[model samples]
Target: MSNFSNVSRRRFVKLAAASSGAVLLKGCLGNPPDTTATTAATVGSAALPAANVGTGETPEVTTIKLGFIPIVESAPLVIAKEKGFFDRYGMTGVEVSKQANWASARDNVVIGSAGGGIDGGQWQMPMPHLITEGIITNGNKVPMYVLAQLNTQGNGIAISGMNRQKGMGLKINDPEYVKGFERNQGRKFKAAHTFPNVNQDFWIRYWFASSGVDPDSDIDLLAVPPAETVQGMRTGTMDAFSTGDPWPYRIVADDIGFMSILTHQMWKFHPEEYLALRADWVDQNPKATKALLKAVMEAQQWCDDPANRQELVQICSGRNYFNVPSEVLTAPYEGKYALGDGKPEVNDFKAGPLYWKDDIGSVSYPYKSHDLWFLTETMRWNFHNGAIQDFDMARNLIDRVNREDLWLEAAKEAGFAAADIPTSTSRGIETFFDGVTFDPENPEAYLASLKIKRA
Candidate 1:
């Protein structure tokens, strides 16, 4: 139904190359090639007994293959499995598949689980929208639904140790400091994100542009796997990288780099990654969709509990999950960071990754306004080359893909307090660290206020 058979010969070739790149990415990360994604649920105990849960309606399907990368954004999925949240909801067969890389995740989602790919799981902003519109799916429109945001404020921009004294913390401070990379160093400021034209890329681009440095022209910004990024930073081949937690902390721990800024400091409570799935699957199994949401929502609340921080860290750091030391995942949970290069240490619990709620409101709710901003930012950078024509088109796409209604249904059914459920789809205006405000109601004004953007 999604027309996978008609992909042009050229686009097919690109997909093949991307598949090869995924294998290369896994090797770069020192992970053995997983011909099939390993099942995360297999490492955890079976579902909780029904007595612990209010037996809601049974789901149409008990199993679904969901994919995730090793990042803080993926904690909810792992927790849902390891903590028996999925089992409590009668969704015992949910498989948390570890993706090789973002590109592989994208390609896998296009194929779907029946074809030996993922149905969907944790995804970066605009990815669900992009996949639905066929902009990034090799021209095959694989409609996706943005179910709920996984977490917020776990992302950071890492500056290689070589530029520790270049005044690159939080803000550029001086445009020439970054612009002089080619003159001072022998090359342009080489930077990368785990994926191109997404949340991580946007964070770094916003930080550079806020200080009057052009992201595209003033630096060489591209996509590189997280492990490759760290290695590049160590060898002085890469100047900076934008990615989610664990890597930012790893950079500091390995003495390869210092965090220029955590995303929490850039835009507090900013929307991060999300849980999405193939729209076809969701459509065919509505009860199962809500069941999945219920499980993840419960897990989010569990993840946010300070008392569960230690167990949460232990579960996420296991070999089947992030595969990093527990300490690498601990500080972000406690909101503690060394923040190398003489910068002051970060020591506030509110600064780390948040799942269920934040200082503002429900982090788990998939706000339509937040989706609009991601689309707007993608358009501002002219990502996908005019695929998103205008704000009106973006709003329409959000209407189709953002399943906030399903999230509300699941929350209410799961016995969430009325205060916890967001009353409105819009979170009002969002303000960034550089004093920029994004009024969701008026995206044109927000775009016009930007000094640097292709739009």
Candidate 2:
């Protein structure tokens, strides 16, 4: 949290309220209706008519049994309900389920029956895509699609409190970052990330690569779940870890670790995770899927509202969920962060909803370059074969997997800027990495051109 900028002016008043011992909550967090004044521009109801949605006429998926793990990344799901987004979109009989873990959630979706217990649920951003490619699971790779990208960025590379006091602290991207480790070289820093090939792993790898350190060789990656990361640090099992939402911030505050590198800075607007469903769910229950999408999108819109941030924190701390004081979750959501080395500053947190969309139908779906970069990484790590057997069809298969067009159509129905939404989204096109630009469309050529590669 050392360097922070570009925070909106609205952040100031919220910070003031927080300091007075008032825990803020947006939408349901006691935030005035006026707080929404700033958010009015973005909230859009769907073009579909939820108005006529009666249990009889509404699509059968009306009972959306959504599954979720109890962690901070699940905000959009919770916000969708609390903020009344689902209601606005005509998705009335929706339920937020508690999942055992990522595997169980995925299994339920794959099983598709009573075991499934639901139509669609939240998933890791890249997971749905990877699963369909036969990377994370072994099955027919059902037609799953993302309705939206939930939260953009909210994590950091953190050290145990023991290490926080080792030096004044570490500033990422600065020459002195790896220097403080001279004495602790042999002492391995146990780092935790959620799952393999997901954003957590991707961002952590990006951070290590940006710092000229090979993540695989330089760090110990423990397959620890997000909920357990805090205790792992408190004890001695994990020395350092990269996780999203409440985990890192909760640990840092308990003196378990000092914030080291922000994942947000390493890759601003890096896709964090998403709320996804089986494509059939969308097709079979078009009305339900759209309603759920609208609700989740509204929740995101609500989360972005600074005025209601404190309230969002309290809900995140519910007994069944994060279960921490509102302060811990509340502060970071508003961009407040500390290095835990006796220094403090405002953090620029990234939050967006590009994760859930139906872009593949539109030209926007096949950001071929974006797919190329992911494919390149998959190949480098032995995840996917380097070749798309049928270059065009593989490209088409990859393109068919996303649903950006659904997002635009829904937005348009809800009275939004339709043309403004592009036909394609390219992770490679933006070239947002630290001082480096990457074009995913031609990943193979880019890989060949790179001066750096595994020996």
Candidate 3:
């Protein structure tokens, strides 16, 4: 509805084909092959082999469709399927559908699997909150339950090669230099993210506002597909983009762009994406929800294991997944990056995508406080035109959607150590690389301390 559109190249094709009455073909939407089966014979021929291990508690339903974008953040879901973690936990009919892009994923979740879409899967920050309120779904309220966080880190800001001499690395020392794009270049600084008013949007906005540039007024920001973003950069039309790997890594690898900063460097172990599902689906099939959680939890642990990293890449790079060469994922998987344009390389294992745990706490837990931060950031930009009016409303929305209690139950059932389960819902204060601290309890003070904000 907004100028950004949140539409992807695949969605554009879908629209064009529908208008022209052309039959849409497979791979057009990047939709994976259906894995549902009505009989045991057909079940045996699903995409990934199922172990069908006994979990004692049988799920109400064994089939579910979860949509995901082709990024490293979706690795846990892919690994869970490929490694038989879903089957081991009694969820034998899990279908991890490949979405065309973020917009397609959002639209699909709204319709749900029964409507030929998806139940739910990976999401950007506060998307579950937004969807539950019908803020982004064109007034079709779809109650969603935030089950668990998919991952943290594995995201970066990439700048076009044209801006190589602009000193746009981890920190921008001169805001005026960037602000002068219009005066010298004949246009505003153009930037893009996969979706508007979400994780990637907030990350780039934070970087800009922290550097004294008003993201809304000082530049042109829009939601574009990752491929189009790269093309815009290659043609020197787009200035920068914010998205997760391996898109950012591909930019540097293909010699089109250089990394300006990673989300990890911006805020180490920051909340990235999440796992959520239709609340009705979750409520009707409670046991199945926990089963799904356990499967993803085990997959997260497996992804974090260095021994399985290579195999993780291999599975995710298959034709049904990311569809890239193994080499494209290797560097980012090992926490090694080129970071071109004279920036120092990042080679720390903890610097890449961390699913289960990070230095300060568990990455898998969907802390209510992190949800509050995302809502607060949305408020900071006055996103959704005041969909979230104040802190009290934001807190109420979080209380309704966040399902950390279920995560705890699943962890205990899966035999996770007592120490691994979090006792509190909050992860406490979060600090950014710009020396700004966000106290979840005193979000008002956090907003008051900001120099540039619409709130």
Candidate 4:
């Protein structure tokens, strides 16, 4: 039996009321609890009452162990917990734990259901496909499902002070520019990324290849933790790194590096991280899964609201969360990016990293075409060579048993109209900064067209 116990409805309501009074008292005393300090005990209860279900409604399984990392992209998960959305959906016993790294987050979920660790949390876009292909789990395929996309367009690549002094600018696509630096420095450029086969790696490789530089030959790529990327740059051990905010923003704030390019510039409206869950847990507790999705979707909407941007930054910068200065978090949320080279601020929609436009498009939907792109890149780099070749096989690995239905169902429950749900699973053709277009139906052709690929 699980050690966690669900709070009864009556007790939950009582706790919420008492907590409200405590919040008011704290505000009056001018010593409010940090937003990141919100836990099950501090949150008191869900913000709203549980929904009423008709006769045949599946009862919600209230206990859950959700895991997360310390990054701004994980804001939706943090908001869902801090604002009582999980409790409102009948999840009264939710524990949101912080993992040390992406690998730790993935491993916790893989062993969670059986080892009392984590049942679900935020994960990379390609993680489910990698796990299903048996690449990362040591030949054990864990059935994972991505219910919703967490955020997008918030990541950037930064060049260290040394590179900046060498006259390296933001445009990395110029072969002559890169060659000049290499010739002047007399050594291959060293770059760092948080992971091996994810967005950061793909973006850096694509940029290098487009610039007529062989990523494998001209640059020495290293894997550094997200928190350590800035330090690595300061110590002159790394020339540049591709990572998500607010680390990139923090590096600029500290005057150690300059922002070269935002990932959104690489591919507009590109998919980033996701809110993933165990397939078995989702199947066994359909109501609970739906509840979790509803809460997270609502949080996503809230985060995208421009009026709440500052408050969101405050919550994310608390000691229990990213633990960074609020200014670093504010830059990306408000679409104000510092170029780190003594340039004026650049304000553009593409820089809105966690964007969710009202009515027109949403950044939270889990499109299968996005998954296919990640899979194709994974294969292009030979991360899982010969494991996923066919389009149908790749689709099965990502959408095992068609779990996107839950996202559609949950979107409806969250008051989204039929128009809000995309008509097709594929987002159609996506064009990159190098004028390369990716069509989901022709992934192999896309792979064949790439000039630099491991496969």
lDDT (Cα, tens digit) per residue for candidate 1, span 267-350: 999999999999999999999998899888778876777767888899999999999999998998999988898899999998
RMSD of 4: 10.0
Residue-wise lDDT of candidate 2 within 378-448, one digit each (tens)? 44444344423333433454455565445544444343233324333443344444565565544555555
* Cα-based TM-score, every candidate: 0.88, 0.75, 0.88, 0.83
Deviation in Å, model 1, residue 435 alpha carbon: 0.7
What would the per-residue lDDT of candidate 4 be over residues 46-112, giving only the tens digit for each residue? 2322222222334467888888888877888888788776666667777878888878877888887
Question: How many Å off is the CA of 373 in candidate 4?
Answer: 0.5
Residue 297 shift from truth in candidate 3, angstroms: 0.1
Which ten-residue region of model 1 has the weakest summed lDDT? 22-31
Local error of candidate 2 at residue 384 (angstroms): 6.2
- The candidate, 1 or 2, that scores higher on TM-score is 1
| Residue pairs that clash (backbone atoms under 3 angstroms), model 1 | none
Model 2 misplaced stretches (Cα beyond 4 Å): 1-60, 165-188, 342-344, 347-375, 384-394, 418-420, 449-455
Tell me how far the alpha carbon of residue 288 in candidate 4 is from the true structure, in angstroms, after superposition. Answer: 0.4
